[model samples]
Target: MRRMYFIFLMLCSGLALAQPRIQLSPPQAVVDSVFFTETTTVRLELDYPGVALRYTLDGSPVGSNSSVYKGPLALSQSATVSAKAFHPDFEDSPQVSIAVRSLKYNQPLSITNATPKPAPQYTGAGLSALTDRQKGALNFAATPKAWLGWETDTLRMQLNAPEAGKVNMLVFSLLDNAGAWIMPPAVVKVYDAGEQIGQFETARPEPGGPTQYHFLEVPLKPWSSDTLEVLVLARQLPDWHDGAGRPAWIFLDEILLTQKP
Candidate 1:
């Protein structure tokens, strides 16, 4: 009986000496994704203290061999990012990876739209605005210089492609501040001259989300055209919503044209 009690005490002591499980925070969508038009700055966070986190951007194994995270990581192109948390006595946390992507369009763009509003000095943009590589944040006015406003319900634009190739994606980055009565469009259409190429639709936000930002991208028919025309029709607000009769505002920045030729 004495020997059995001694062995049980040893097991209990060993269990008590073992280190606790470490929990690391993963990148959340709104906070990390969709915040930029050209480049995205990602920061790492953890749920527990005293953990040393290491990360890699090149899809390599993450460990002490990887770069120790000291500050926010900036990514300009697509990468498979991996991270792991390390502690002295505890087993290393499982590797966490996320595929990060952004539009890499720096092509000079020529734009022609019907009845386009003059971009305001501080908060608006013109035809050349989309390719300017500027980005907006959570606030409707955070990156105002990058945004161009249109008052009409319908918008028509003709864009000249920089390279002749297949465009895989078209990113429509937009802002939603319903209280200010600025909302996303009901439907958007892309045309290569007269033929329809791609179409995108948006999901309405549950009421009471003020100043929300969303990236709405759609797959193209893998279009190959020198010039593309885009049409956007805003959703008509109901009587309960303010700014009726008044034209819905379409705030646009970086109409990202992602192509691989």
Candidate 2:
């Protein structure tokens, strides 16, 4: 019969290509480059070896004992963690993602809780005389003791705006002496209580290691003040020595001034 109808159509096309392929094994975590503080712990791994594995956070869904995680999973906050795997007949395996952050360290220059009543005066002019690595850290007396002039140096800072809208935001963190120096693309000016309302520059240096820590954001349109001024015109490093060669000390942390209900 024509060789049994060509071997019964090649055994029904080899049982329709043996349909049954489920493979997935890639999802692990342990992330923290610096977020300061919030919470952190995420660990996950899968091959579906025995099936049954579900997860979701920042998406929601995965609760039975709610802590099964076989190998590597930790998350604290600022998230997006996902997972999927469940075979009973095969039909549910396509969702894997891991992204996390949260070490919470937002100091933005402490002013000891200010609402009003004399709390804005730190003057300016290359302010840097609290070393020992800045004592116990955390200091924001309305932050504005500025100084980064080098190469004909001449920078300033003195902002005291307790009220008045528009100034959006400004957050800072920088330390150098071989600790956090990689911010090069100058031109940053935002003075309000002295005039000028905006100016921006800095974008390049995103591959870190070694005393690493960088975070900066600027945006201003609203203005109302008690006093404010910050100017940095930097450029002077022909091996600008430090630790004795002078000129090599820039440490400003958590200096925030916000207004946006």
The prediction achieving the highest TM-score against the true structure is: 1
Q: Which lDDT tens digits does candidate 1 get at residues 1-261?
A: 999999999999999878566445442222366434467776766655677888888668886878888877778776666778877756687676554456554344556554555436433555676666566654656666677777677888777875645456676767677787778887888887688888988765455554654456755675567888888888776556665555557777766667532
Residue-wise C-alpha lDDT for candidate 2, range 1-261, written one tens digit per residue: 999999999999998878766554433433443232446566555554666666766645544333345654545554556666665665565555443434242212223221122112332322332111221112222334431212223345555455546447654445322432323224557777667777766543233222322334466766766565766543333243232222223344335554322
Give the number of the best model, judged by lDDT. 1
Residue 193 accuracy (lDDT) in model 2: 65
Each model's TM-score, in the order given?
0.59, 0.26
lDDT of all the models against the reference? 0.67, 0.45
Candidate 1 off by > 4 Å? 1-40, 44-101, 104-108, 118-125, 238-240, 244-247
Candidate 2: C-alpha lDDT = 0.45
